[model samples]
Target: MAKKKKTPNDKNVMAQNKKARHDYAILDTYEAGMVLTGTEIKSIRARRITLQDGFAQIRNGEAWLMNVHIDEYAEGNRFNHDPLRNRKLLLHKKEIKKLQDAVSDKGITLIPLRIYLKNGVAKVLIGVAKGKHEYDKRETLKRRDQQRQIDRVMKRY
Candidate 1:
């Protein structure tokens, strides 16, 4: 029997915040659903979302995603969604409470790692992260360089 091949729609990643990993020490991760407008959904499906400056906050018992830029759909007219609007994240009450408590601590924050479509629905991967210090950043870079060198040597064999 042959294994089934995965299709693009299987795990369509829309946008990722590459800088998040370099700047923060991720402690825990959670998957949350997003509340998006029609045009926003279209733009996301078209791969026009940017998670570079995105972050999440728990306010009034609700989780809100901020600074994520989902470009307006090109074909959308007056009803086009705002590119930088704050979107609500759908997380369970228990999860939200835990995130809120964690975020209340000093130097800890909630960052969006990536957004992807699962079973035709959009989901955001969020991380409970603590900011990295200068020396930590340098150490990470050094380790990454060493890993690259090891990979190159292995490939040559």
Candidate 2:
């Protein structure tokens, strides 16, 4: 009997910021738990979340996630949470301090990269990113195109 090949488990990604890599240079990443309402979680599980314009802010020694859109649940009626309310990010004191220091520097900001479920719990992947110049963005695009060409050539073999 032939053994079956093992496949990696599928990650339940709720939302992603597709433009993050194009707009900034990611320096460091951190995973954080989100404080969500019952309806908010259901909406997220249904993939009704958007992270394109989401960002993290460290204020008063705590971290908060802003601009992440979690659409109101269809059946929630009056119980649905606000779609644009700021959500608190659960992180340790040490991590919060690190984020605060990084964010205090010019051009350095905390951006939400993606949101996914881990062990049935919702988590946000946040990144410390530096804003890229126009030339840097062009260079990144050029490099990506060159890599794509190389991949195509290798696949032809």
Candidate 3:
């Protein structure tokens, strides 16, 4: 019998909202499928996507991703989809209910963390987050600075 080698993940991340992690405390994360057009997928494949100001909302028992901008494919021409259109997120009914309940609480929000392809399918990592206060954000910055200083000191030894 021949030995098989494991392949590393080569899926390219389309876009990531790094600010979301810095500005918000993520309580839970869920991977949900995104409904995209053919051109949209092509655009995503080319990494022409932005998730800086994107969010997820549970409406009418379904999840919708809003403000996710996928640029038009240069080769698609007239068949290209809208740039900032709302895309539906595919989640199970039970998971949707859970997310809706968590979102209903005060001071909690739905933030899109990143968009990536898993097994050739587009998936969005949605985070259940709570906005951080100014002092909290400052504390995070302080800790990060302290950690950097410690790393520098250790590297010199």
Candidate 4:
């Protein structure tokens, strides 16, 4: 049997924060399991989650996913989870310690890069990123355009 290949567009990926890639220079990434409520999981399975302004933080020896918006499950009655609640991220103690140390550095922060389901479990990919300057953003775009042009030319041959 062939090993399954993974891509950004993998069928398991439910939501992606493309804006996070544009706004931050990601240095490192970690995959973490999410502790979701019943309705939250339902909403996520329906592709009703947003990662636009979502971030992660290491607080008091635990990791927390903040500002991620998972819409309420329509069938849920009064037991619906809050759309903007801070959800717990399940990572090892060593990982949490390392993340805390990395976040302690000036100008470094944690941002959720994407959310994907792995083996029926919801997981989040968080990035340790540094803010890019305006000029840096422009440079990145220019590089991207040049790469596209190169690909186009190569494809013609």
Candidate 5:
């Protein structure tokens, strides 16, 4: 028998860490599968997740996601998973080594950028990032405002 595919909601994004972009300059990104509990997946499907403070780390030849908040399922009773527990990220050995090497540099870190469901499986997009300086943020904001102004003027035509 052939396996069925569940791809209707392809790239269904559940949560995004908007602050991560403002706080860090992303250098590279990798999509990683997550090891989630039953209730945790339920909560995620309901869009009750917050990725604001989440980050990924490579340890013991594995990738781990930390500080992500997935709300507990209301009907989960005693089986509900912890909202802020560290979750294991499924990544290839080579990817884990690459991430480990990337973070070994000064000021470079691994951060979670977004959580999305791809083919019914929960995945996290991790970014290899460097902390942005205060002035870099201001520059980004300035450029954004200028783009908005330009677009506004063009929209008048």
Candidate 6:
């Protein structure tokens, strides 16, 4: 008898913020647990989420994720949570203090890069990033264009 090929089980992925990496220089990354309501969790599990305009902020020694939109579950009733409400991020006190100090050093900002489900719980991967200056952005574009050109040349050779 032939053995059947196994299918890899991947945790559900909700959303990603691709532009954050392009526009900011990522310094540090942290995986934070998200506080979610039943409806929000359900929505995330269904892959109904958006992170394009999402961000993170440190307030009162705590990390709060803002602008992440988890659409209401299709079957949700009046118990649905607000789509754009600020969600508390679960992080250690020491991590919060470290992030706070890093931000105080200037040019550092908290950016929510992606949101995914791990072990059936939703989590957000946040990064400590600094905004890239115009020159840096231009250099990135130049490098990308050069790489594309090199690939094209190699393919024809």
Among these predictions, the greatest TM-score belongs to: 4
TM-score of each: 0.89, 0.91, 0.90, 0.93, 0.90, 0.85
For candidate 4, report its TM-score: 0.93
Where in model 5 is the C-alpha error above 4 Å? 1-11
Ten contiguous residues minimizing lDDT sum, candidate 4: 4-13
Per-residue accuracy of model 6 over 1-157 as CA lDDT, tens digit each: 9999532234555777889988999999888998889999988888899988888889998999998888988999988889999999999999999888888878888988888777777888899999998899999999999999999999998
Q: Answer with 4 or 6, whichever has the higher TM-score.
A: 4
Q: Mark the regions of model 3 whose C-alpha exceeds 4 Å error after superposition.
A: 1-11
List where candidate 6 sits over 4 angstroms from the true fold.
1-11, 152-157
Encode model 4's per-residue lDDT on 1-157: one tens digit a residue: 9998554457888899998888999999999999999999889989999999898998889999999999999999998989999999999999999899999999999999989988888989999999999999999999999999999999999
Candidate with the larger TM-score of 2 and 6:
2
Candidate 4 residue spans exceeding 4 A from truth:
1-9
Q: In candidate 1, what residue range of length 10 has the lowest lDDT sum?
A: 5-14
Clashing residue pairs in candidate 4 (N, C-alpha, C atoms within 3 angstroms):
none
Report the Cα lDDT for residue 89, model 5.
96
Write out the backbone clash pairs for model 2. none
Instruction: Tell me which of candidates 3 and 4 scores higher on TM-score.
Output: 4
Off by over 4 Å in 2: 1-11
List runs of model 1 lying over 4 Å from the truth: 1-11, 154-157
Q: Comparing candidate 5 with candidate 6, which one achieves the higher lDDT?
A: 5
Decoy 5 TM-score against native? 0.90
lDDT, each prediction: 0.93, 0.91, 0.91, 0.92, 0.90, 0.87
Model 3 RMSD vs true structure: 4.5
lDDT of 1 by residue, 1-157 (tens): 9999543343488888889999999999999999999999999999998999889999999999999999989999998988999999999999999999999999999999988998889999999999999999999999999999999999999
In model 6, how many backbone clashes occur? 0
